[model samples]
Target: MNTYYYYDDKFLLTLYAYLKQTESSIVRGLSDKWEPASIYLEKHSLTHKLIDTLNSNKINPNEKFDNIFYKAYLRVKGKQFITSNEADNIYILLKAINEAIYYKKPQIYILGFLRKEIIKTSNKIRTRISCKKRKLLADNVEHYNQHYNGKFYTIEQIVNGL
Candidate 1:
């Protein structure tokens, strides 16, 4: 936020509330189109080059994915929402962030206090959908997170593989 770079809106700050980055503003971004990779993200931070695909049927953080990913990786992952309720929640959060970043709105109240709360507990908003839909949305999100919209990599990890 030092330079305050943004998307079409204050998408950055709202994103900051979810993911984080280096303050100097030199960033390497990633897309949420991420599939079930290795269990590495749990043991270490998020700096993997290429990852193994998940054999299980969950999207959490373990051999089965952890739910924390849903909150922590929203920029790359937010589009996973299935219901209008979840979609609207994502829309509202993004719009509020836009207002906050551009119009000087309060981060805590508008964005909600805890980042976790914003996604699940605060408003208790859950965009849970069927796994079939989840996979489809994941494909679309990967496109946006990688090509169309993309995002600044808040949590950075150097790739040792490459």
Candidate 2:
């Protein structure tokens, strides 16, 4: 089966940065960042109001744009909507999802600090991708007995082992 991993914007950017700094294993989709922005612009009345208010007030173009995005982001803040619209939060989420769904791999593997409660809440293709936190670990921690000082294994190690 072809697998697709969907994540919020921030995580994707971090994964992009990581790929830039190191290896080129991860390839991400364009869906993360602007998807929400498009939705905000097209559907959300609040976003429309923000844009209208900004344009009507003749706010500086850059500041007006920023405020519109900020308000749109705030509209989904603190909820499961990427934790926070901060670059870090979006980056982390996208990175994890990108890693999980890297390429069009037949069997997708999601790895990250995914929380259990959130998994239970999912009920779709997304649910398939999300884990019950680390239920895999709980189910078979023995398989992952070795730890690299509580850190991610280096790319070299993964390459060598594979």
Candidate 3:
């Protein structure tokens, strides 16, 4: 199965830094694969356009870039997460990126580092979700958990439970 890669601005920046600093064959191969996806995303994504607009000062300069970027990033990430079933592909890409980072900085503890980073980045992005939305999501998860006796529930299962 073909796997789609999702690249948020933070990931892109990290990747760019990695590409600039790394000479590893594994990293180079991943970069080569990523280049086409990056081009396609740049040409087609509304999020990319928003980023360009923000960068060009078309948007209010006083407005927080993190807020705007996170909103766009979440929209893209949410849509991709909801629609895609290729979690293994995401894991593979993430592993490559994490490996590249580890190879660059060998001193840092590698175990669970990528997982922690993923959680941290996700929490940062998720903070952009309004309190009301967050509450609703929490409620939904709570409801689902109760209904399913703590077993994980898919969206379909959640809807059915409701």
Judging by TM-score against the true structure, name the best candidate. 1
Q: Which residue pairs collide, candidate 1?
A: 20-154, 29-153, 32-76, 33-142, 47-157, 59-65, 60-65, 60-66, 61-65, 61-66
Which residues of candidate 2, in runs, are more than 4 Å off? 1-61, 65-85, 103-112, 115-162
Top candidate by lDDT: 3
Model 3 stretches with alpha carbons more than 4 Å out: 1-111, 134-148, 155-162
**Per-residue lDDT tens digits of candidate 2, residues 3-83?**
112232222222222222111122111223323322322221122332243233333233332454654554444211222
- For every model shown, the clashing-pair count is 10, 8, 0
Q: Report lDDT per candidate.
A: 0.26, 0.28, 0.34
Better-scoring candidate (lDDT), 2 or 3: 3
**How large is the C-alpha RMSD of every model relative to the true structure?**
18.3, 19.3, 16.2
29-138, model 1: which lDDT tens digit per residue?
11121121111222322112111111111133232223556434533544222233533444454444333333322333433332343334222222222233322322
Between the candidate structures 1 and 3, which one is better when assessed by lDDT?
Answer: 3
lDDT of 2: 0.28
> C-alpha displacement of 122 in model 1, angstroms?
11
Error of 1 at 69 (Å): 26
Ranking, lDDT, top scorer first: 3, 2, 1
Q: Give the lDDT of residue 42 in candidate 3.
A: 30
Per-residue lDDT over 20-102 for candidate 3, one digit per residue giving the tens place of the 0 to 100 score: 22212223324344344333323322333323432344223323334656546756645311112333333343454444343
